[model samples]
Target chain A: MNAFLNQLPIGLSIGAVLLLVALGLTFTFGQMGVVNMAHGEFLMAGAYTAYMLQSWAGRQAVLVALPVAFFVAGLMGLVLERTLIRRFYGRPLDTLLLTWGVSLILQQVARDLFGAPNVQVKAPTWLVGGAEWSGIRMPYARMFILALAVVCVVAIWFYLARTKQGRRMQAVMQNRELAACSGIATSRVDQRTFFIGSGLAGVAGVGLTLIGPVGPALGTYYIVDAFLVVVAGGLGQLRGAVLAAFVLGLLNSYVEYWSDASLAKVVVFAVIIGFLQIRPQGLFVLRSRKLT
Target chain B: MRRLREAADAVASAAVRWRGPVVFVAVALLLLVAAPAALSPFRLELLAKYLCFAIAALGIGLAWGKGGMLTLGQGVFFGLGGYAMAMHLKLAEAGPGQLPDFMVWSGVETLPAVWEPFRQPWFALLMVVVLPGVTAFLLGLLVFGRRVRGAYFAILTQALAAAFVIWLVGQQGLTGGTNGLTNFTSFFGLDLADENDQRVLYSVVAVVLGLLYLAFRQVVASRFGRLLVAVRDGEDRVRFLGYDPALVKTVAFTLSAISAGIAGALFVPVVGIISPALLGVVPSLEFVFAVAVGGRYTLAGAVLGAVLLNYGKTTFSEHYANGWLYLQGTLFIAVMAYAPKGVIGVAGQVRDFVAARRGRAAPAVVPPARVEEGAAA
Candidate 1:
């Protein structure tokens, strides 16, 4: 029971990280239909942003890093949306290829700017240690991330359900033509949604720094799994991303406990493939009338 | 009889189409000689390596360009074929059932059951074609049968490739693990290190690629080819016309996988290595990249894309080791945005421009390929 408790935190922490990353992805990729392969690189950019701020501000950087990473990565996302992604709005494959190209460039640029090797950031003093009880210990970093993820998910849910802007975004997502007819500024909403989505990814990247070293390839590593989260969660559904992330993350952690990391990955993939076979529409799906 | 006359006319039209083949064969023969005479041995080998990629690209042209499956997991097939060939070579070198060195090192005293069959050259050669083919058949049956396609299919395949790499890396006892199988000395009684043999291998691959190119050209021009394109453009319409879109896609995908597998088998001997790194998501993406760069709409474009981009990579990496990726990345973005159809499409545009300036009748400019909507994963 004690060892299970020890293992549970690790699984939950990984799940938390995935949930944060997937939260960003679920909006831009899932709702808006933007196939941003560079989404992961945006995460990497956030990590690097956190890294840069850490050097400048020292131990106190963690507190400021989340919002800073959000704005920095969000601004980059906004710039990308306006300059490149806007042109390929309806063209998903082209967006995928173009964004992938952007991802490649971003990765190379990160390597050029920060050097190729992994760089470590010091955890804030507040998040340095762990909570322990009867030989079972959970790291403060993991605990903080879990709480942060829950808060973010709840905040996003509230924004979607209660806020005027969020409703407009949902309106645009559901029926763009109808939304445009009803005087909703669809493009502006797209821009803002992309900004917030990318900002969330940046936040996730900062969250990542609490546990491990930051590198250029960090985003690339998580992007696919995040995509899996989005896909398995069903398109344009936040709860699905949360549910999928937690399931995959927990499964991966438990598998990793039994075998090496590589085998664990294989098992996770196998499980996903099997799951997808059974439920092609994914775990959750929203329905709408189709006059076509 | 009317049927006999129609058959005769069919043969006649096919003969007329032979004009394209004449030019193709001429190009092949020219390349066949020019490769050995113009380039040094090392460069010739590198060209051979590129030709292997071109073979895979040809498959992409058939599957993606014409059939429109957007397969992003050709590397799995390629890896299967390469590993099959590499295992054969490794086992052959291990001599009459002594077991591979790595397996021994990993504490296996005898050859595993799966590795035992690979000891035979013929079985390995057969497997190079069969392994990827069967795998693709099974995968296509499962995925396409369920109507899974487009970006979802692309992502599924990408994940599969990643999973394949991880599986290979984890199974140290079976595979060579992450380090992979290397240190090959010979293949089929010929010394791999010999310059003459290297040229021989290069010529052999070049000829095979040329043959495959011709084969695919005909396949694309045939009536079945039209059906494949129809399936791509409209599945429901094709179903109304009494063709199963899923089966058509499966055939195309399976063919693509087999071609990638053949390329992999060739790659093992020319490159002298097979590893999980070459079979990962990145390499699979690069396969698609080569297709995109070459102009996925045309056969020659696919081959050209593979050769040129790969050559550029080797040259760029060699010359500017530190930051060549930046240039490559920029080039990819520029090409994707400005010339999404790649060099052939660009040339087509320029030709139209010249004709327009001269006030002559411009040939119809081909529009860029369309990406299907709602397939966004």
Candidate 2:
């Protein structure tokens, strides 16, 4: 019972990480319909940003790295959008292969810039310890990641719901033609959406450094999981992403606890496949009148 | 009787009208007779390995190129076929009741129940095709029936590959873990260590590839092929026309899986190992990469792409190991961005350009042959 109780926080933290990584994908893949396989590389870029910031700020780099990584990753995404992904707008599968190529190039670039070995970032002094309550231990790093996920989620919510630009973005997601007819610049909206989506991945990468290894190949490990979250959550539905992330995270944590890590992965995938069978459109579906 | 005679005459005329058979015969001769005679044993083995990949690529050409299902996790099927072949070979090498070396090393007390049936070579051979076929059929039905496709299907398939590798790696006792099933001495009584035997194996693989290419060519030229393309271009329209798009897609997916399985089975003997590393997400994606580079739409293009890209990979890695990934990435981007139809499409375009230059009245632009048929349909 105690072990099961302990897994709740662990599950939540894992869900938090998944949410952070998948949040950006919900925008590009879910809303914009561009399978930017290179999104994971943007996350890698974010982690590297944290690694770089450590030199300037020492142990305090993680805090400073968050905003910086966001823009750095966001700008990289914007450049990719303008240069190559722009051409393959309507063709999602082609975009997938194209971005995968971009991802390969970016991974090699990362490998070249940083030696192939993983680089370690010293955790902030505050995040090194853990807090215990009623015999359940919670690491500060996990809590920090969880907090960061919430902040990112709330901030994204604010951006999309409260802000005028966010509303414009939502409008485009709903119906690009109607959005364009309303004098909203759909192209510009696409750029902003891609920027914000890729930026969130950067932020997710920053949060990840506290828990995981930072390396060139780090993105490939999480890319599929992040994609699964978006896929299960239903495209362009924020609530669905959040719900799916936590559900998958809890399922992963519990399954891993019962079985081995590898078996847990297989079980999670099997479950996802089974879940997809029942709900092919995912947990939620966007209502649109446009015929394909 | 008159109508039947006319139909036969038209079929004969059509066969003669197109230069397809001449090209087919030329390629057949080159692969079966000329190339085997010219290349050394080592080079021939490498060619055989590439041919295994070509077999898988042929399936991808039909499914992804022609039918529009981006099957990114072909490695799973490939691995299934490979492991089946490898298991039988290991059992045969062990000689009657003895465990394979890896099983002994891993301290497995007895042959696992699953490995029991593999002792029979025929059962293993049957499984090589059946396992992946059934898996694809069920998966295709489940996913396609629900209308999940495009990037969703691609991502799902990729995740499946990742999971498969993880599963393979974890089962150290059953699967040989990360090292995978290897060190085979014989295949169906043929001594693998003998150079002549290896050459014979290569010939078998080459012949199988040739036969598969011709068979798949016929499939792509059939009525169902047109429906597959129609479903790819517009699934709802096909559904509205009273055809079940899901069923059509499932058939193509199953066929692709079976081919990939056969390729994998052939790959084990040709390459001499079947490991999790070879059938992971990266390798599966590489299979698709070969298809994209050659021209996904054409059988010849897929075969050429698999052979040529693999040849390029072997050569490039030998010269500059670090540059290969960058080159591969650039190639994928360049192909998708500019030459969507691949090398075959580019060749068609060049032919049209030259022909237009010679005849000023002719239009400069002509659609690639297969794509033109698809569009016209």
Off by over 4 Å in 2: A290-292, B1-18, B351-377
Over A65-92, each residue of candidate 1 has an lDDT whose tens digit, in order, gives: 8899999899989999999999887767
lDDT score, candidate 2, position B44: 88
Q: What would the TM-scores of all predictions be?
A: 0.94, 0.95
DockQ of each: 0.51, 0.50
CA RMSD of each candidate after superposition:
4.2, 4.2
Clash counts for the predictions, in order: 0, 0
Q: What's model 2's TM-score?
A: 0.95
What is the CA-based DockQ of model 1? 0.51
The residue pairs that clash in candidate 2, if any, are: none
Q: Which runs in model 1 stand beyond 4 Å of their true positions?
A: A1-6, A289-292, B1-19, B353-366
Lowest lDDT 10-residue stretch of candidate 2 chain A: A283-292
**lDDT score of residue B245 within candidate 2:** 92
Compared with the true structure, what per-residue lDDT tens digits does model 2 show for residues A1-292? 9999889888999999999999999889888888889999999999999999998899999999999999999999999999999988777888889999999999999999998999998899999999998988899999999999899889989999999999999989887788999999999999999999999999999998999889999899889889989889998889899999999999989998988888988898888889988887779977654432
TM-score of chain B of each: 0.91, 0.91
